[model samples]
Structures are given as structure tokens and as C-alpha cells.
Target: MQLFIHQMNEEASNDILTWQYDRPYDFYNNERTDEALQEILDGSYYRMNDENNVLIGFFCIGANAKVPAGNEFGVYNEDLVDMGVGMNPTYVGKGNGFEFCMHVIRFIQEHYPNKAIRLTVATFNERAIHLYEKLGFVSEDKFQTLFAQFQTMIRREHQ
Candidate 1:
């Protein structure tokens, strides 16, 4: 499936919440709601969309929620940021996830230079793990449960 990456606008933001509310991949089924979507659209939280001219899925990058202080992925530092992404079920397994992540990596790296950018993946999510690894994200010895996914921290190195 073809995907286009873009910054989240009001309409897309609403769609993201509506679609992600009960996402199978989301650890917390309650994470997505009209309020949460409004926060993203308001810019307190940031968002990105994997659009095929339509909303397939979206990502969130928030402040002060970077790398955790303790984790198994072995990354224990504060010079990083945390992000999460979710897609509409119709777009699952269609490479949109990987593409959205790659786009996010590029966006974060360019926007937050000299600081590490990080993401968490579930231990059981081999597909996501592989995708992050392929994108040059080194997996930390860290793991946690966010929603339902066994989270693994991945950090992007400075180029």
C-alpha cells in the first residue's frame, strides 16, 4: 500500500483517535479518545500521519516523556524522547508501520539534533522489532508493559 507522510491537522487528528481507540496493537485500549486527540491537535502532543491521501495511521511525539530512567534495553539516560504510533486496522501489515516509523525517525532526528530519539516496542512484536532494527534503532535491554505491548527501547544514533 502506498503511504504519504504528513503533519497531523485537526481532521486527521480526530480520525487517529477514532481509529486507534480500540486498536489491536495498542496496549491501552483507552488511550485514544476525543480528549487525547484534541491534545494532539492542540500541539501539547505532536502527531504524524501515514496517509494514502487518507488517514491510515498516525504517530505521537510528546515532551518530557523521553527515555525512562529504568529499563532492560539497557538505555538509562535522559537525553532522549519517547514516541508511539498506531494505524487503522485496514492498514496493518502493509508496510505502512515501517514507513511511518522511518519517517518519524527522520523527522525527530532532524528536529531534535544532538539528542537521542527513542521508541518502545513490545517484546512479542517481532515485526516491529525487526523494522526498528532495520531503521538503525539499537534495541535496549529494556522492556516494559505500556497498554499491552512488551515495550523495548530503541535509540537512534547521531549521524
Candidate 2:
């Protein structure tokens, strides 16, 4: 599928703010709030859409970024770009995982080529972990928050 990554705009962000996912995936859904709105407005996030003009998902990259799982895994170094992503509820389980993630990885490779990418995912999210592993991300560390255990995965620039 052809995907385009666009900087978040008011309309897109507003649309994204309303996305709701099911059960386990609900953890990836976002809430609409002033702070969240500000982050979208500040260019910390981007909207991912397909060639058909459907909004597929969103991805965030940077030093001051807090991914989907929050900071439960603790802070990463400035040299590493903490990346996060979530697919629209409607697009969650139709075998688009690998493509969605590869697009995000390429997006980072193009824009922030010098920085390594790091992500934190719930330990129970075997689907995502499997995808990450298949894509060459190494399991670097693990941590636990009050809610769930998370695994920190990284794909260095050389890998």
C-alpha cells in the first residue's frame, strides 16, 4: 500500500484525536486534550494516510517524545530518537502491520538518519514484538510500570 506521512494539521489531528480502538488495542488509542492538542500542533506528531486518502495511523519521533506506552520504560539518551506509532482502529488487524512499520522506519531513516530509533511496547504485545524482531530491532531492556511490563527495542543506524 502506498503511504504518505504528513505533518499533523488541525483537521488531521482533530480527526486523529477521535480514533478509538478495541480491547488490547484500546491501549494505543489516544485521548483528545489541550496538552495532546499542543503536541500535535507543535509538530511532534504526523499523520499517516494511504493512497486512497484514508488515514492509516500516526507516528511521533524526537528527543522530547513520549511514545504510546508513556515513560514507563524510563528516559532514553538524547542521541536516540524515541519513536512511537499507532494504527487507526479500523486498520488494526488486516495484515498491514509490517507495511505500516516499515514506512515509519523509512520515514525516520530519511528525516533523522543520524539517530538510532527506540520504542517501548507492552511485553504482552507479541504481534508488535514479532514485527519488530522481524524488522531487525533488538530487545535491549525491560521494565515494568503499575499497569504492564514493557520491552525496550532498538534498531541502530547500522542495522
Candidate 3:
């Protein structure tokens, strides 16, 4: 599970656009466009790769993404770093989620050690919620947005 995390470059972003996932998961897919590359270059996204240098996935940290009911769900807080992640569709549902998340966690720790982490997920994303719990995140609140219900989870220092 050797992994590396780096700021996404144009080449990496272009490659990522080719990755796909199943229904629902695919809804969060990246786009193949210049705007996508610009977003990556802006530093809101990261490119992840394995020891062999194969692109594995990508994750977002401290992006301040505005989810539905962020305030109501208590998912957004100044004290905690917000994280969002996705694995290459080719690598998902094959028992690699935990490892992928661990890499993202380690990357975050390297840059923001001691900072608590928070994430918001669709209520229907049971798989992601399970993995987050496995990684020491606990749901703190839940709320409904205009489009869907969301749950806010947090991984505090004590955890």
C-alpha cells in the first residue's frame, strides 16, 4: 500500500478524467477539461499514486466545499480540516478503500498535524460512512439539503 500524494499537475488531472466509477459514485467524477486542470493547479485537489507510480485516486483537503446544509449539519467548522476523496473506479469495491483513505489521512497529517478532520457524505453512501468510521470518524450531526440528506462526521484528536 505504498502511496504518494502530490499537488495535481495537468498531466495527472487529464489522466484522472479517464477514471470512472459505478452509479452514484460516478456522480462525483472529475471532468476532462481545462477548468478541471485549473482547479487542480489551484491547489484544492491532490493526485495520489502508488509505489509503482500508478495513479490510484485523488482527494481534496481544506477545499471548503459547500455542501447542502453544511451549517445545519454541523459539518463545516473552522477548527477542523474538511476532506473529500474518491478512488479510481478501477480500484473501488475491491477492498482498497481503507488503504486509500489511510493514505489521504497520512497526507493530511503530514501537512496539518494535530488538526481535526471533518467530512460530509450523502446519507445513502453507506460504504463511505462505514470506511470513515473504520478510520476513526464519528457522525456528529445529520441534516437535509435541497437535494439530499447529509451526515457530518469528524475525526478528532482524541480519536
Candidate 4:
């Protein structure tokens, strides 16, 4: 499956903001708010599409990808590339994550060469954590937010 990455646009941003995941994962759902839209339009986020031009997901890097709560715990002290990802609800658990993630990883590697990568994921999301580990990310720190526990994982530049 070939994936194309594009700068986040209003249509794709609106589509992503409405994607509702089941239970637990629903925490990722967003309201169609002005602030949310601005974040995607600020140039930190990228939309991913399949060969047929179907929106598959979105990925964001830098500060936009960092969990705000993690700042208090110093979980993001390092100068690494932080990444956040969300897939269309319909694609969840359909076995396309590995490929989707690989594409994102490659994109980051090409754009931010030599920097380590970091990801913050909910601790209950074993499926996602396992996928990150398989992609060479190692558990670095764990922290708790008001709503959930999270683990910060990192894949060093050399990995």
C-alpha cells in the first residue's frame, strides 16, 4: 500500500476531528473547535492518504505532538522529535497499522534526520505500544494524567 503525505487542509482536518473511536480510544476524539482546526492548520500536522486518495490518518510533530501534561513531569526534556498519530476509526484494528506507521516513520526520518523520535501513548493502549516497540521505540518514562496513564517511548536516531 502506497501512502501520500500532505499538509493538513481544512477538509482533512474536519474529517479527522469527527473520527470517533470506540471506548478507551474515544479519548482521541476531538470536537470541531476553532483551536483544534488552527492547530492542524499551523503546519505541524500532516494528512496521510492511500493510493486512492482516501484519508487514512494524520500525524503531527514537534510541540503539537507533545502531551501538555508531560511537561510537569519533565518527560519531554530531551530535544527529540515528538510524534502523534491518529487513524480513521474505520481502519482501527484492521491490521494496517504497521504499514501506516512505517510510512510515518520514514517521513519523519527524511524530514528530521539524526534526531531521536518520541511518542506518548496511553498505557492501556497495548496494541499501539506493541506496534511502537516493534518499530524500535523503547519505553522511556511513564506518567499519569487526570484521565489516563501514559507511557513515553523513544526510538533513538541509530535505531
Candidate 5:
């Protein structure tokens, strides 16, 4: 499958909705509500897809995001663009994740020299941890959630 970057127009809203419904934990929570998505797309975040019109994921270059304990503003400071991606749940476990992300990361890194990409996976998500590490991210530090559960997680950073 091939990938294309599209803006969130009238046509791609459905795919965004599909992603929201599929990954509630990461994409449909309070932080990623309908309005949040609207903002993301409205901000011209790059949406990913293949030749079949399948929505792979999306990422925003130079996205200034708040990373709980980590402030990612000007962190990469050069060509680094902060990116995030999600694949439709139905298409998961089909071995497309690694290839998909690898392509996205390489593309962005080449275009944005010295652009460091970063993502946050839950402490319990080993598959994602391995994928990020395999893609070259390093474990920076362990951070504790300030919420009532007081759970902790290791923050991975890559450049």
C-alpha cells in the first residue's frame, strides 16, 4: 500500500470519525473529542492514506504539543517535527503498522533535517514500546501520572 497526505476536508471527515471510534483510548478521549479533531484538521494536520483510499493515520509537523511532564516546544529546535499517528483498529495486526510508521518517519526526517519525532505509549503497551524503540526512540525518563491512580510510565524521546 502507498501513502498520501491530505488535509481534513469534507471528504476525509468520515475517515477521521472512523479513527475516533476505533481508538477511544488515544483518539476519542476528552483530549481528542470531536472538537479537538476539528481543531487538528482545521490546523492542517497531514492525514495519511493509501492508494485504496484507506486511512492509515495522520501527523502534524512542528506540532507544539504538551507532553504532560515534557515540554516539546522548540525541543527538536531545527528540522524536527512532532508527529502522532493511528491506524484503524480493523486493519490492525495485519503487519502494516511497522512499515507504515517507518515510511512516515523517514519521509519527515528527510524533509525536516534534524527533526526528532516522539510519541507516548502507555506503560502497559509493550507492542508500541518495542515499535518506537525499533524505530530509534530512546527511553528518556519514567514519569508519574498526577492523577488519583498515581500510576507511572517511561517517557521515550527520539531525535
Candidate 6:
């Protein structure tokens, strides 16, 4: 699937806020609130669409992608390009993760060349963790928040 990343917009952001995932994955769900919409439009977030123009997911970089608690743990010490991603619930478990992630990685590389990429994920989400690992993201650090434990993974830029 071809992915096109664009500046976050209200319609796509609203649609993303309505996506519902099952059980544990529901932790990533967002409410259609003013604050939520504001967050997505905060400049750091980008909307991802497929070749067919369907919203496939979204990506957020920089400080917005880092869990606040990670600061206390010193997990964000490195100046890596941090990223947070969310796939549309409908596409979740459809074996599209690898391709989707590669597209995101390439996007980041183009925009931020020579920087290592970092991602923090809930430890419970083994599937995503596995996909990241397969993409050359190695386990870097682990930190716990009041609600969940997260593992930070990193993929160094190619020389």
C-alpha cells in the first residue's frame, strides 16, 4: 500500500478520534473533544493516507510523541527523532503493519536524515513491538507510567 503523509486536518483528525479498537488496544482511542482535536492539529502530528485516499493512520513526532514520565526516567536523553503512530482500527491486524511502518520510516528519514528514530510503545502491545523489532528497532529503555509500562525502541539511521 502506498502512503502519503500530509499536514493534519480537522476531517481526518475527527475520523481518527472516532476509531474504536478492541480491548487493550482501546487504550489508544481518543475522544472527540476540543483538546483532542487541538492536539492533532498541533503541527507535530501528520495525517497518513493510502493511494486510494483512505485515512490509514497518523503520526506524531518530537515532544508530543514522548510520554511525560519518560523524562524522569531519562529515557529521552538522546536527541533521536521520536515518533508515535496510530493505525485506523479497521486496518489493525490485517498484516499491513510492516509496509505501513516502512513508509513512515522512510518519511522520517527524508525529513530528518542522519537522525536515529525512537518509538515508545506499551509493553502489552506485543504485535507492534515485534513489527518494530523486525524493522531494526532495538529495545533501548523501559519505563512505567501510572497506568502502563512502556518500552522505548530505536532504529539507527543507515550510513
Work out the TM-score per prediction.
0.69, 0.88, 0.87, 0.98, 0.68, 0.96
TM-score of candidate 1 versus the correct structure, residues matched by position: 0.69
Which clashing pairs does model 4 show? none
Q: The CA-based lDDT of model 4 is what?
A: 0.93
Local error of candidate 5 at 131, Å?
0.9
Tens-place lDDT digits, model 6, residues 1-159: 788999999999899999999998998878999998898899999988999999999999899999999999999999999999999988999998888888889989999999999999999999999999999999999999998999999999762
Q: Residue 154 of model 4: what lDDT?
A: 98
lDDT preference between candidates 3 and 5, better one: 3
Query: Candidate 3: deviation at residue 127, Å?
Result: 0.7
Q: Using lDDT as the measure, name the better of candidate 1 and candidate 6.
A: 6
Candidate 2 collision pairs: none
Candidate 5 residue-wise lDDT at 60: 59
Residue 35, model 6, lDDT: 92
Question: What lDDT would each prediction earn against the true structure?
Answer: 0.61, 0.81, 0.80, 0.93, 0.56, 0.92
Best by TM-score: 4
lDDT-wise, the better of 2 and 4 is 4
Error of 2 at 35 (Å): 1.7
Task: Please report, as a residue range, the 10-residue window in candidate 6 with the lowest summed lDDT.
Answer: 150-159
Q: Count the backbone clashes (under 3 Å) in each candidate.
A: 10, 0, 0, 0, 2, 0
- Can you rank all candidates by TM-score, best first? 4, 6, 2, 3, 1, 5
For lDDT, the strongest prediction is 4
Candidate closer to the true structure by TM-score (higher is better), 3 or 4:
4
Report the Cα RMSD per candidate. 4.1, 2.3, 2.1, 0.7, 4.9, 1.1
